[model samples]
Target: MAATIEMPATRRPIVVAPMAGGPSTPDLVVAAGEAGALGMLAAGYKRPADLIAEIADVRERFTGPFGVNLFVPADASCAPERVDSDSAATGVADAEGRDRADRVAVEAFRDLLVQAAPDVHVPTPDWHDRDHYEDKLDIVEAARVAVVSFTFGCPQPHVVERLHEAGICVLVTVTTEEEAHTAVAAGADALVVQGYEAGGHRGTHRVTDAPNQLDHLALLPMMTDVGVPLIAAGGITTAGDTRRALGAGAVAVQAGTTFLLADEAGTTAATRMGLTDPRLGSCVTRAFSGRPARGLRNGFVDRFDALAPAVYPAVDQLTKPLRARAAQRGDIDGVSIWAGAGWRAAREAPAADIVDSLTP
Candidate 1:
């Protein structure tokens, strides 16, 4: 059955992009509501208990509508122990990328391991996609979050059905028309049409497929009547861009770069600094997490992935300590500063101040 929600014609029209790892927080969510935009708290990379806390926090602060983005875990059935202490797990490097390394990367990784005690064995990441989905769903529904979204791809039918049953609005991020159709068929309440120029990770369902670079303007009408509300994302860096998206058929627009430097954002100083500097122009690479994500081009992405395996949370885990250390030493060259092409438009200010750029 098709799902439905009680959206008004004059609903505040902007949706905040959920950035993981500190950038998207409860404060950010409240600011989105305060600014008359819908904020989405990132549930990615956080434990279920932690996500619950954040949902509660946002509920306490904002009575208005908001969304929570879930990183739908993939169904790869590989054993997590395969890469544990596996030295072959060493990341592969590239020729042009080797020169980009700053001195602090490896040392930073080493020091953090000493403290976090990431197993001396270094097992591949223990991935449980369904577990994360179910646990998070319980929290979002309990909190009665107004909106819920999925990334990397839409979920199975049953999963989508459950969210709808809870009276929550669900949106899925898609990079292509195929995914757009797939999401609608699976019962998504809306679609977040992510374009190529957008930054951070591309939400292509099949990890191996080359990402579609169709800009939002071109892709928008191409979707033609997807039979659901369209919430456009990717590459929207300014108010003009937002207007264009809605003009092209989007019910609302979403953006990520502006939050890169928001005071409430958990972005590290290294990232905040690099994103603003022109010398650190961004590039997409599958190095750090074995997925093609756009970030401030760095030595780490340049060198690795020459032989980096396609394993995900595994690759993500192997490099966590390395990234943590580099960030600690203020090494922007080695850290991943995921930003959209609009990093140039990002402002270092409060979240409420940042979303004002997108306010209608």
Candidate 2:
């Protein structure tokens, strides 16, 4: 028998989205939990030891309920290798040669990067980055967080069972109704219905699938039959947006961009500036990372979006050094300023205050 994991009682219908890569801090999660809402710790791009330390820190300061978010590893089997005598490295090959095309596209983009910014030396892409999927899961299971949420893809049944056995409720993020159904079938206790307006990466399961750009309200009606607690995410910055989601049948709302400017967030100066820049606009681009993510438009994206391939963490790894150099110099154009459509409405305040404002 699977041990029953009880859901945390959150008084507020608000959830702090796990803005991985820096914004998700222990203080931020603690503040949100203290404010009667559920906060999430992002385990993406984190070392297992570091994440365990953070779990310990958050547990010590805040006894209330919180969650941990993990990125499900991309299926490497999707890309089969074939010899391309003309290519510089082993390239992916499809029956129709689509994989070879992707490799060519990525190489072209790489050349563009070199020419665009000669001073910044980019690192060799790490093809093996699964974001430490299994190790992170082990840490989460051992820590026994109140909730364990997955993004990028749905977890296998055994993974869900293991988490359930450890007394943790599982939540899967979905961008389409099909994904919602898949999550429900996979035994997710809840669904994070992320719409196209969300900041950062679109949680579409397959890298090849173009994200459905539906709004939360529009997608809500499509997912009502999934029969699980629904958490609406994306473009939810103001109280009105929160009200709309709840009225549309969501049990809770998750907002990330609203908290980007929060005192507790580790938002970079470049990101902060881009978020507030009047001329900057948000758009979906795979320039920074191979996967499609929404961010404030800048020179780098303008130059590389067309050239970028559909590859994910590989492209992400390729751009790491360049982004880091840009960040060090406070150059907004070169780094990713991940923001949602409502970025202009973001305010600088405490995470608790943001939760309070969003709470009805």
**TM-score of candidate 1 relative to the true fold:** 0.84
Model 2: CA > 4 A from native: 1-6, 76-101
Write one digit per residue (lDDT tens) for candidate 1, span 1-360.
Answer: 536654323246787789987788888888878877788899988899999888888878777788888877665211111222335434233312332331133334334433544444433344443447667877887876778888876787777777778788878888878888988888888888988877788887755456876888888897867888887888777778888888999988888877878877777788887886777877777777766788877777666745444445556676776777778888887678899877888887877776767765
**Clash pairs of candidate 2?**
none
Q: Residue 216 lDDT in model 1? A: 80
- Reference-based lDDT, residue 254, model 2: 95
TM-score of each: 0.84, 0.92
Candidate 1, position 97, lDDT:
37
